[model samples]
Target: MLTIDTCSSADVDRLLGLADQFLDDWAEDAVQGGKPDEDYEQRSTEWKVIRPLLVSAPTMFKGLKEIARIRQSSSDPVAICCAALARTALDGFLIAEGT
Candidate 1:
């Protein structure tokens, strides 16, 4: 099992920020109504492959609860969006890292 204790709050926040950027870019691409940007396609492909595994993991609930807490505590829109993406990325990391 992955050790949630290994990650500090700042680290979690940083990861959230990056994930948010990814999501924002994806949204922008969708709004364009043209071909998806290469980066967005790559990230979306990665998400599709990893998402089902994450949902099946027993630790998902704890990660989700922690993300919800983070989201609720953040007043900034960017922070809230980031926190939501961090929820998925956290699970993805555990599976990808096999930790």
Candidate 2:
């Protein structure tokens, strides 16, 4: 996997693992007692850092939705689109930060 400057490999792995689990649970309802696991809790907490950004740049909301769609795909076409969306989202985030 391509590495980002801001995130360590461990972070990437944890995020991907959590996402994969969520996807699986979504399809089969494997989560016991219908309760979220620790991974889900961690992912939700991580959102707190960026939730403010979302409030500032409502336009990024669509980009985030597109990112979720992109995340589910394993196709080459989707990979290309994912790269574009990543750039757009990053740019939108930077702009929102006045950077």
Best by TM-score: 1
* Residue 23 C-alpha lDDT in model 1: 76
Against the true structure, candidate 2 reaches a TM-score of: 0.27
Worst 10 residues of 2 by lDDT: 1-10
lDDT (10s digit) by residue, model 1, range 9-78: 5555566567668777777967597765777777777876865554444355456667767888789898
- Residue lDDT tens for model 2, 22-83: 65665454366487566655655666565454344434444565675676665677676876
Quote the lDDT for 84 in model 1.
74
Q: Each prediction's TM-score against the native?
A: 0.32, 0.27
lDDT of each: 0.66, 0.58
Q: Give per-residue lDDT, candidate 2, residue 38.
A: 68
Q: Count the backbone clashes (under 3 Å) in each candidate.
A: 0, 0
| Model 1 worst lDDT window (10 residues) | 1-10
Model 2 ranges with Cα > 4 A deviation: 1-5, 30-93, 96-99
